[model samples]
Target chain A: MTSAFWAVYLREILIMKRRILRQSASMAVSPLLYVVAFGCALGAAVKVGDRSYLEFLIPGLAAMASMTQAFAIATEINVARFYFFAFEEFQAAPVSPFSYVLAETLAGVTKALYAVLIVLIIALLFGTRLNYGPAFWGALLLNSFSFAALAVALAMLVKSHADQSLLTAFVITPMAFLGGTFFPVDALPAWASAILRFLPLTHAADAARAGAFGLPPSPLPFIILACCSLVFFSLALSTVKKARN
Target chain B: MIKTESLKKSFGRTRALDSLDLEVPEGELFAFLGPNGAGKTTAIRILTGLSFKDSGKAFVAGVDIDKDPLKAKRLCGLATQNVNLDSELSVRENMDIHGRLFSMSAKERRERTRELLELVELWDRADSLVKSLSGGLKRRLMIARALSHGPRLLFLDEPTVGLDPAIRRRVWSLIKTVNQKGVTVLLTTHYIEEAEFLAGRVAFIHEGRIVREGTPGEIALEVGKWAADTFQDGVLKSSFFADKREATEFLAAAPGGGTLRKVNLEDAFIHLTGKRVL
Candidate 1:
């Protein structure tokens, strides 16, 4: 089972490695823009908590980057489904469903980590040193898994590139901005905050900020993210079986 | 060997397979002939563990497919109709990944990859990306990848679907070579001549069930040795005869001239199912 999981994972890694420059470029754009357009401009004017806005912004950027990169698996999955037909390849093989899910989720996490590195580099250049502790890594990982699993489920439901793009546009993008990636959910109206609380990314941002400030995020966010990951993973699994039919 | 008893599958209200029973004896080169949507692919997918059967039994190499899918899948290899190989990967790399998925050791994978690539004559293009290869080469590589794990039973689902005649013939020879090495092969094809040339036994499927199945000669003999087809106002009426002498004689007596020819498997299929295999 482990070997089978590695087989699927390694295939993605190999493709990513072959096209690393192209792959990296897709991730590079947002960080460059965010750091330049927001970080430098707002650094002196704003204070987010006990620290500078740049420091607070770095973790949020990391959280958002990881979330988007992880969820980018949906686009990759759509390509495999619509073009390469790799999903059918795995379907025909003797691989178990759990292994397939594990492999794809890992691929999403791996891509998210690569984005994390990009954000780290940007932070370094901007003279922002945030926490590099276990809590930070753990929250980042949980955030990746939840979003990646959502990507897998959505990938299965949508049939075409246009539909996938619409999902990215309407669903993922809204979640990215509203989930407190760019600003504080606490600043929003009570009813607006209630809805944002339901999104996994909202908790992810909270957890990420806590970790960046060298504090442990509340167990509540971790629990919610864990439940979300499990639910999304289960949905992806059923969708895989449905797609075969 | 492959066997399915009362196997049923449905997608929504459309029954793709309905109590379908299939039998292929050990070491036989069996061809499943059917028109589009005759349920050939659905059956293949179910038997190969890519899809689940609604009810009933399917076994590949003696293991029940539903009960032991992974174990049964281990005994079978499928070269699908489409060129499903990863286009970005080299020919060898595609085969290597298949080997890895099946848990082949490094040395075994290396050696098997070499042997199968050479067998399919893709060894020369082993280092080339699959997308860069011609259609024929990609099909050949798909076959190589399917065989990398050395499965006992091989399923070729319209393996030569879109290839030109020459490349089709080349694929035919490769399949023959593989079958000769004692692998039980179940092939599906719309090309009637392909079935006649390669199949030891042929089965005709229509509306999710087998209409007729036998040796190519046996099926053809049921419709007699000869047939004559005469067209009137874009409609063709056919007549079968016990021999060419009788067929030609009938053709001569017909109101309009008719084309008399020796009955082939396609004629036999049309005679039995009233539907063209294509």
Candidate 2:
């Protein structure tokens, strides 16, 4: 059983390697511009709560990269499986539905990992300082996997590429903006804050910023994100098991 | 060996596989001949455990598909109609991954990759990206990849649909070699010539049902004894025999100027399935 899991993990690594080879240039351009646009220009003009714009927007942009890359990973793979090759290889192989989904989710997280590392390095080059520690790394991983699972689950349910864009535009973008990525959730209305507290990214962004600034570690956000991950994972697994019929 | 008993599948309101019954004996090259939308793909997918059957049972290598689908799938290899390989990887990489999926050790996987690539005459091109290879080379790679784990039974759906004649012949020879080594092959093809060349026993499927099943010769005979005609001086010339039995009688009765040959699977398929091979 452990061997099977490793095989799935290695396959995911190989898949991500291929993705990086194919899209690294395009991916790098987006994050590079974000670093210049928000971290430099916008940082000079605005104050996010009490922190400088560069200090505040840096963690949020990093989290944004994590979410978009995670979602892209799942959506593109699902499209390739259904429309490009029709997933014949996976279907004929001994790998179960759960294993296939697991591989895809891992691949998605890897994409987010790639995007985060690139953006983080660029931020550091531009005079942005972060408190790097184990807690920060842990929080980053948590956010990547949570968003990947949710994205894959959503991909399985939708039927068209245009629909996927609509989902990202109307759904994921709103959450990123409102999930305390750009600012603290204390500024939100009471009802919105109550809902944001349940969101994985809200906790993810909070955990990330807290760790980056050398603040005391808190378990609430991790607990909430872990619960969200569990829900998303189960939903993805069941969607696949049901969709095959 | 493979067997399906009253296997049925439905997509929305359309009955893709309607109580289809199919069987392929051990060491035989069985062909599923049908037109587009004839449920040939649907039946093959269900039998290979790629799709679920709405009702009935499927077994591969004596393992019930529903009860032990993984076991059944492990016992068979499928080369689908579309070239479904990972284009990002090289030919060798694709086979290696398939080997890993079957849980082969690294050394064993490498060894098997060498053997299969050599068998397909693709060893020299093993490191080439799949997307870079020609259509014929890719097809050969798919066949080799299918055999990487030593599957007892193989499925090739429309194995050589759109290739030049020479390349098609190359694929045919490779399939024959695999079957010669005791692997049971279940192939689906729309081309009458392909089915005739590869299948020891052919089943004619139409409208989601097996309309006829027999050896190619038997099917030809059933369509009335087939006779070959030759052209001499731009004029058609031939001799007709009574049936499959009259081959000897006609040889003795008519001294050969040009010659007369027996009918082929193409004529039999047209007679039975009532569809062109296009």
Candidate 3:
């Protein structure tokens, strides 16, 4: 399991290693602009909690970045299946489907970590500092794992590159904007808040916010995240098995 | 090293393999000849564990495929019809990834990578990305990567489907060399010349069943030693002859023009199945 799963994960890292600069640049561009435009326009004046809006926005962006970067693996998986035939190679090899999915999920998590770094850099340039502790990282990892597993399940369901792009546009994009990234779910209308509370990203953002402020997050969000991650993980594994044979 | 019995597979209403049986002795170069859309690719998929057999048994190097797919897979190396190498990675990285999938040690990966790259004559291109390679070069690299783990059985599915004649012969020689090193090879090819030149035994499959199976010489003998083609009534018909002396006399005594040539595997296939091997 170690060798085979690492083989798949290491292959992605090896490829990413060559294009690390381009990847970092791409990740940096959006967060950089968001920080400058949003932070300058309204962030300095508004305060989400004990910190300025800019500092508050840092954790939100961290959550969003992890979700987005981790979910980005859907496109890569589509490319491997449709264009490069690399997924078929894995299927034909001696590696188990579970290891392959786990390796891909780890790759997605790795990307999320990189994106977190990029967002943190943007926060530093703005002189916005907050708690960078284990709790913060644990919440961040949970968010990435949940979303990356969802990405793998979605990749298996999608049949074409166009469908993959559609998912990014319709599902991921809407969730990034509406799932408590810009405003707290508690701040929404009572009826809207009821529905928003159920979104995984909403819990992710809330938990991550608590971590960034050096406060202990409640166990409920982590429990919900664990459940969602397990569901997505199982679905992805079964879908992958179905696709192979 | 490879055997399947009563193998059955289907895609919707389309039956890909219907009670198909195949056997290849250790170190034998076997070729499966069939037209497009036949069960050739499907059968290979099941044996290699890329796809499942509906309700039959397949054993690879004594490992039952459906029962122990990983063990079966570990015993064979499949270079599929399509070049499936990671185009973004360097040639050596592609080989390295495969070695790691088989759980080879670091030292073994290094040594095996060198050995395979040199064997396929791609050692110089080891650091180059796979996307940078020409079609012929990519084909060779895939073969090298397929052989990276040194499995007892090698499955080559149309290894030279689109290459030019010169490159095809180069690949053919490479395959022959690998087989000579005691690797059992189960290959499929559209080129009758390829099978005739490389295979120790050949099987012709059509509509998911083996229509004929035998040595190249033995199969070709079904259409006799010589063949005469006559075009009349806007249609071409072929006649086989066992005696060359009689065939010569038969062609010379013809009142109308016709062509006579040596009976080959393609002729035998056409005569038996009413379909050309190509």
Candidate 4:
């Protein structure tokens, strides 16, 4: 059983990697358009506060790239399992359900990591003026893993592939906007700020910005993010149990 | 090596298996013959420990499937009806991964993979991608994968449902070779000829019940001699099989017994299930 668990995990990683590579052309093209259009063209016309709009937009683009890919990876993994082939091979294998879920989560997180790295390299090459250290990388990884778990948990609860697209519109897209990826939560009304504070990505972006600028994240927000991650991980695992049953 | 006592399973409003009892010796080729949607796959899943039984008990290789599924699964190999091989991997890579799942070391995996590949006549295409192989080659690869870890018992569901006649016969020959190696084989198929040719003992299942169980010839004999009738003018003529002496005796005594010929498993299957074999 131990060997079976590790074998499945390793095999899952390779499968995910191949899938990501298949989408690599799109990944490369889409991000270039976003960075070039929003950062170069729009930056020439608009200024946010005293900073160049392009400079301010670079961080958000990085965060958006990470968050969107993370969600895509998590959601597609379960969708493939349930709707495509029904995981017939894994179902017939000796591996346990817990091990299967763990492997999937790791695979999703790794795919998100690949997306983040590709986008970051592009951002750097285009002279997007990013100043962040290892601390920023650490926060990005944490945010990706936590969000991947949440996405997978939600995906498991849904019964149809169409529900995934619905979720992006109703849940994921709103979180990105409200999470302060593109604008500061404080710029919104008081009630909106209060609501946005509950989003995991808000805390993640704030922590990332703080670390990148050599500032410290508020301890309270850090605790909140950690607690939210734990909750998401637990929910993901519980959903796996329901799915297997 | 396998036993099930009043095994039962239900899927919502449908009852898949009900009070079914089965026993297979350590090394026998047993076939489960049934019509489509007749609970064949459900029963096979329970025996393989891949699904739960609503009630009763199932044991494979002395291990209770529900209580010790891991142990039970380790003792058996399963080939599903749908082709489930990873299309992205080569035949050898697929076997290597299967061996790794069984905890075989890399060295052992290579050796066992070679042996199984040769056993299936797929050694020449070991490095080719599964998607590039012909249907027969892929099916052979699935068989080799199932035996990669040297499992004592193998379970196959609908092993030859969609193959051409030539390929089906080739697969049957391969199955005979595997059985000759002393491995216990359990298979379910709608093809009566395949079962009649390869099965040592056969079970006729219909509506979640075992209608009859025995050697194919035994069941055929017990079902009584069958006859086909034709009409000539206003009279009906029939032909069938009976003992040469019995035919003479019947002819001398009463005229209604009719002529007899040997009955095969297909006739027996139709008699017990009352369903035509496709």
Model number with the top lDDT:
3
- In angstroms, give how far residue A76 of model 1 lies from its true place: 1.6
Q: Which residue pairs clash within candidate 1?
A: none
Q: Candidate 2 vs candidate 4: which has greater TM-score?
A: 2
Residue B168, model 4, lDDT: 88
Model 2 C-alpha lDDT per residue in residues A21-119, reported as the tens digit of each score:
557776667667766776677658878766787888677777777877887865665666666563567667787777867777787788887888887
Preferred candidate (lDDT higher): 3 or 4: 3
Q: Model 1: per-residue lDDT, tens digit, B215-239?
A: 9999998888888998878899889
Candidate achieving higher TM-score, 1 or 2: 1
Ranking of all predicted structures according to lDDT, beginning with the best and ending with the worst? 3, 1, 2, 4
Q: What fnat does each of the candidate structures reach? A: 0.72, 0.56, 0.92, 0.36
lDDT tens digits, residue span A1-245, model 1: 97788888988888888889988887878987887777789566887777777787888888899999999998998999888777878888888888888889889999998998889888899898988787788888999998888888889899797899998899888988888877889889999999999988889888988887888568998899899899999998888767776
lDDT for B226 in candidate 1 is 81
Shift in Å, residue B151, candidate 1: 0.9
Each model's number of backbone clashes? 0, 0, 0, 6
Score every model by TM-score: 0.95, 0.90, 0.96, 0.88
DockQ score for model 2: 0.46
Give the higher-lDDT candidate: 1 or 3.
Answer: 3
Which residues of candidate 4, in runs, are more than 4 Å off? Answer: A16-21, A74-86, A154-156, A219-222, B225-262
What TM-score would chain B receive for each of the candidates shown? 0.97, 0.87, 0.97, 0.88
